[model samples]
Target: MSKYIQAIGIWFLIIPLAIINGGLRENILIKLGDIALLLSGIILSICIFVVAYLLIPKIKNCKQTDYFIFGIIWFILTNLFDLFMYISEGGGIKDLLGSYNFLTGNLWILVVITTFISPIVVSKIKKRKGEIKNV
Candidate 1:
């Protein structure tokens, strides 16, 4: 698929996640207390999405395995960065990490899946188009 289509897919994943998370934040966390982290979470999630999506695809042969490995690496890397931030800043926004859901964390994982699937799907389309052109 084209980048436009990929972006649409990303938006599809982001929107529902935004709704669910917004609800959870208002109903559970905000009602309880600790909304100081709200702005940071929004910023972080978007930043992570933008940075990872741009950075990951450019790397050569970034397969499903590559995406998965990169995801795990980024997960660890974020935690490590958080560790440093926590140490330096007397606990920054990253310290409140568990406040969000992970099962479908803003559909970031979906990007990883797309990384795996997009090449296969796009390549097949390309091949079919080439055949049609030849015929």
Candidate 2:
């Protein structure tokens, strides 16, 4: 239970990183035109991985499967949160779904995929290094 709490708590940290990334994308990366979205997605993906690498190992008694489950939870929650935001902003299904169109330079799908995999990937690395106990 505590492990679940800790894993969910880590997501709070990710939310701020994502907001900051959005700010950077809007303020700085936007100057780069169409590439800004892709670059920001890459940056956010790296940030998510870094956060997971630094913190997931601290989750007591978690195996790689637990980490993977955490990733799944985060992925679902992340999408839900985005959906809520879009809806709140007067966006309908099209607006929400449109974000996934990578051909239009929106890398939201990549970001979600990264969010869905970061914890497990980090756990694998930590397990390889013997930095975590339960594998």
Candidate 3:
């Protein structure tokens, strides 16, 4: 139970990272044109993985399944947050759904997928390093 809570707390930390990433895309990466979206998505995914690698090991005694579940939870929460943001900004359902179209160069889906895998990937890395035990 505590581990789950800690996971959620760590996810909250990611919200700020996302905000900062978006800010960069808007202010700095905007000069890159359409490629900026792809770049920002990649940057955010790497940031997410780095965060998971640094924090997931601290949740002692986590099993492989636990890490997978954490990823699933974070993925779903991220999607929900995206939905809320879109709707709040007056975007229709179609707009939100359309953003997933890779043809448009919107790599948002990739970022979500990355979020869904980071925990599990980090767990494997930590286990290999013998940094995490009680698995």
Candidate 4:
């Protein structure tokens, strides 16, 4: 579905940003093996979210609100995890977290935040076509 496409698109955008940061420090995660792990995470996360949506079967009409919360949590946690991962790989957590230009970090941040948010956004399109649950 279009949602899956959108999800993959978001990953393509974010993964590059992560790779840039990861590679800037010569972090090993930017290499082929780690790249595979990263891709797998993104693809799997997307599939899980889609399946959750399909199986839940009864979302509240407050769809945007639900997704906003999910996106915020996901964004914060994803960044934090990345922060720590880079730290463990020999980069200073504070440096990586604090040294970036706001503009640059914001791109990756937005990519991450919106990856989770896209589901809610895409669902609105389907909801308009009456793909909604009343339960």
Candidate 5:
């Protein structure tokens, strides 16, 4: 539907910003090491989820389902972008896939989980607040 399309559009806008943030984090990580990288990634994931939560409500006719769809689209597109960048930079498919190794390179998984759950969490928070206000 149109709402889903709009969600995709919004995601397109978000993707570039995320890539820039990721690049900056990667640079910082090289200097500060894994702990700093992991901590920064966790913090960034929280911030991204919060932003998505706040923005989702503003889309006209958006429902919980739409947010899920948006998350899915965003995730797929980001992975594709990563894949493209890897290949373009002369990296192999194995390396591209290995980047997902949870034991080593799992920070992205946090982002994935946050993206999927953010809408639901935001909806619940809003509902709880509404209930509290009414009572």
Candidate 6:
């Protein structure tokens, strides 16, 4: 299969995992409040990045550009999914967007930034490991 197709497949696979993460985050917030939510975000970010790093190499024939494009698509899809969930749960668009506010709501910025960067970081890490092995 082509890299683009593989990327799309990976994006689809990630959606459910993202939803699960969101659910876990919500539960944690309900139980422990914002501090736990923030900590969970950091932990979840690390776990997701590690998973991406491990999984990216399995996509045969994917180039660095493909990884980056996948990251962008994943980022966009995740935010849209979040918005959908928020609205489905009876939230207004304002509430959906307000969670992105760094000052008050949870640290969604971390997740946003991590989503944008994870694929690129994974690609570079894999490339570096290949170089080290070749040397």
Best by lDDT: 3
Residue pairs that clash (backbone atoms under 3 angstroms), model 4: none
Clashing pairs in 6: none
Greater-lDDT candidate between 2 and 6: 2
Candidate 6 lDDT, 11-31, residue by residue in tens:
566666666766877775557
- Candidate 3 local Cα displacement, residue 110, angstroms: 1.2
lDDT score of residue 15 within candidate 6: 64
Question: What is the RMSD, in Å, between candidate 2 and the native fold over all Cα?
Answer: 1.3
Q: What is the per-residue lDDT of model 1 for residues 9-29, given as tens digits with 9 covering 90 to 100?
A: 443444454456556666665
lDDT of 3 by residue, 1-135 (tens): 589999989998999999999999999998999999999999999999999988988898777899999999999899888988989999866877887898888899899999999999888888888888745
Clashing pairs in 3: none
Off by over 4 Å in 5: 131-135
TM accuracy, model 1: 0.42
Give candidate 1 regions above 4 Å deviation.
1-34, 89-135
| TM-score between model 2 and native | 0.94
How good is model 4 by TM-score?
0.44
**Ranking of models by TM-score:** 3, 2, 6, 5, 4, 1
Task: Provide the lDDT at 55 for model 6.
Answer: 70
lDDT for each residue of candidate 5 in 1-135, tens digit (9 for 90 to 100)? 476676666556656667766777777755777665576557657776767666655566545565667777767766776688888989866776776676784576777667666755665576567521111
TM-score of each model, in listed order: 0.42, 0.94, 0.95, 0.44, 0.75, 0.80
lDDT of 2 by residue, 1-135 (tens): 588789889988999999999999999999999999999999999999899889888888876678879999899888888888899999867887899999999899999999999998888888889888773
lDDT score of residue 42 within candidate 3:
91
Candidate 2 lDDT score relative to the true structure: 0.89
Give the winner by TM-score: 3
Candidate 5, clashing residue pairs? none
> In model 4, how large is the Cα lDDT of residue 88?
88
| Winner on TM-score (1 vs 3) | 3
Regions more than 4 Å wrong, model 2: none
Candidate 1 vs candidate 4: the TM-score winner is 4
> How does each model score on lDDT?
0.45, 0.89, 0.90, 0.50, 0.66, 0.71
Model 4 misplacement above 4 A: 1-62, 98-107
